[model samples]
Target: MELSEYCALDATALRELIRTGQVNAAEVETAARQAIESVNGDLNALTQPLFQSALDHDPDGPIGGVPFLVKDSGPFARGVTFTLGSRSIRGAVAAVDHELMTRFRAAGLATLGQTTAPELGLSYATESLRYGRTRNPWALERGVGGSSGGAAALVAAGAVPLAHGNDGGGSVRIPASACGLVGLKVSRGRTPSGPLAGEAGFGLIAEFGLTRSIRDTALLLECVSGPAVGEKYTLSSPDVRYTEVLRADPGRLRVAVTTDAWSGVPVDLQVAGVAAEAARTLEWIGHSVSPATPGIQPDDIVEGSMLAAVATGAALLRAPVRPDPGRLEAVSRALLAETLAFTALDVMAALDAQNRLTRAVGTFFTEYDLLVTPTLAQLPARHGELDYDDPGYSMRDWLRRIYQYGPFTAAFNVSGNPAISLPLGQSREGLPIGVQLVAATGREDLLLQVAAQLEQAQPWAGRQPSVFAG
Candidate 1:
């Protein structure tokens, strides 16, 4: 297959072609490599190239032969450098595959290489001193949202069809919104996290990926989802596969719509308008849409998220190979110091607050089937818009800035509910505008059904980025 033809197919379509012998795995891998070489220089998406290693993947595995990129943060493959977008761990290599990585390989995905992430996956924008900035494929001057920014950029640019990403406070969905892709963060414990750390971001982080098509996301979710042994929280398996769920209709439902940022930050008019428009679309599809938000305070979410993040950060800093203070980013160092100062009582208080908020949001979901909101408070920010290195920056200032950009997303992370960002509209400048559809915890099936409905109603497949290979 030609590079153009290869780039055009999503993971599901590519898998079908390989299954039918219409195209061989090697041909597809070659097409992916050529596509990456064509655009990665300008985009700076892939931080490493594992072309030879990818070629060694099992060709007969399910969805086998599809080129995939793993974010450099946490998805580890044995022998591959696992830089968490920090200079401290530059030469570090994973001795074993992460559980998610093992599953990805087992499902027949060829690990092409690692993509860039913000240092320690702390920031919402993928601009790290370690690997430089990952620019959006639609506009070079704009930032691709992070910590899944590099993966989103590669997929948006057509360098790859699907790429691994994990979300703790909007890491996956933020970039998916910026890049015009499907990004789903599953309910907590729906996927495994083991053999390295028990849970990431104190259970706020969920492992997943960004894809151009909803079916690709569904197929991957089906492939990698399941509880590992001794998992603290185990969710019951879905009665039907997500791949089959896409064809089913989500009955007319009650959806709460909110343009207001939970943080009380003034949302950009255009962004809010787009989200409101999406609500109208849902109404047209026979769902009851109303302007209602969860009865939780923005301050509670901010505090809870910071508490979890700081604790997680402190734990990570305690790794066997201690990082040099000078080598760490200014914000990372500052946050680490701040977290180190936190007392046990303070940590417990934060956890208590998070649990309360989670329960409150859960209660709200009992009244509504889903919640609709602007995935972002505004359009994608310009490169260097959010400063993480300034010594004067406080945790509060940082939260305010990030929440302004991604107010709707972090709450779901805190609540451990299933949320997805769908590219439903575009700004006047032509940047993608994504609207989020959030379902109660363990309701990915409902979210996917609604998402597939939206995808069919307004398809984004024809939209191409400025840096696309085709």
Candidate 2:
């Protein structure tokens, strides 16, 4: 298959082609490898390319024979180097496949390699001492939102149709907005979290993927979603297939639109206008739309997210793969120091804050079926702007900076609500602007329904970045 042909086909389209022998698996895989080679140098995507594994992958799963990239910071594949974008931990490899990784294999995805993430996924930008900045394809000088930055760039640039990424404090959605992709942070308890442990980041982390289209997003969810054995979370899969859900009407949804950040962070007017326009479009679609903001304190999210970082950092440090202090970056050193300083009671208070915010946001959802906000507060920032190496910051400070840049996203992450970022608008500079649609917990089915409708109403297929797979 030609690179242009491979890039043009989405996961669903490519699967059908291979399934019918119109295209062979190897041909698609080769195209993907070449695509990566063609763009990886400029985008700094793909931490490691495991293209050889494409040969032996199972060919009998839904969406099978599709090229996929896993985030370097997550869902460890057995024997693959699970560098959390850190220079430390020499020779550390995943001893077992995470439940998600197993599901990825079972779903017939050819794991091409790992994409870049921020060190420990702490920052909202994918720049670290381990792997340098992952540049946005939209504009080469801009940053790809982290820590799923590289995955988003790859998918956005059409190197692959879909790539695995997880969100805890907007990692997936942030990058999605920045890269103009479909990113969904599944609700808490909706996916697996065990085998090595029972839970993650005190239920803030939601493992999912990013894609170029809503149909691909819906299809991928059907392929890899569902709880595994001993997993901490267990939500029912879409009652019907998500692709089927996409076919139906979303039906008279009451949507709340907010240009004002609940965290009191500033939202750029251009980004806010795009969100406002999305609200208007929803109203035009026969849905009720109104301006509203969740009643919550900024500290609730900042504190809760920082505490989760503290917990995740503590766990990683205590594990056998602990990094040598000398090998750690300044930001990481500051993170560890901050983690050591935190008292257990402070963590309890953080949990209390999480509970309070979750309850407050959940209360807001009672009146509104959906919440629309800018997926990012500003446009994709220039590269080197979200500096991770600065030792002057603690985890809380870092959280504040990143969250302020994307105030709306973390609230949903902490609330455990399902949120999707769609590329619905473009800036005057031609950069894609993402509008986030958030649904109550475990409402991914509804998210897809509305997302598909929006995708149909205002198609983004005609737009491509300055740098694309072709």
Predicted candidate 2 versus true structure: per-residue lDDT over 1-470, tens digit per residue: 98999998789999999999998988998899999889898998877655466523567888788999888864388877777888885577778888877888888999888899988888788887777888899999899898899999999999999998989899999999998888999889877776676878888888889998889888878877887777777887866988899898878999988888877778899999998988898899999998887897999988778756886778766886567877887778888887788888988899899999999999998999999989999999887788888878877888888877888888777788999999999999999899999999889999999998889888998788988988
> What local distance difference test score does each model get?
0.87, 0.86
Q: Which ten residues in a row have the lowest lDDT in candidate 1?
A: 49-58
- lDDT string for model 1 (48-153, tens) is 7654658235567777989999888753777787778888775687788878888888899987888999988878889988889899989999999988999999
TM-score of each: 0.98, 0.98
TM-score of 1: 0.98
Model 1 misplacement above 4 A:
55-57
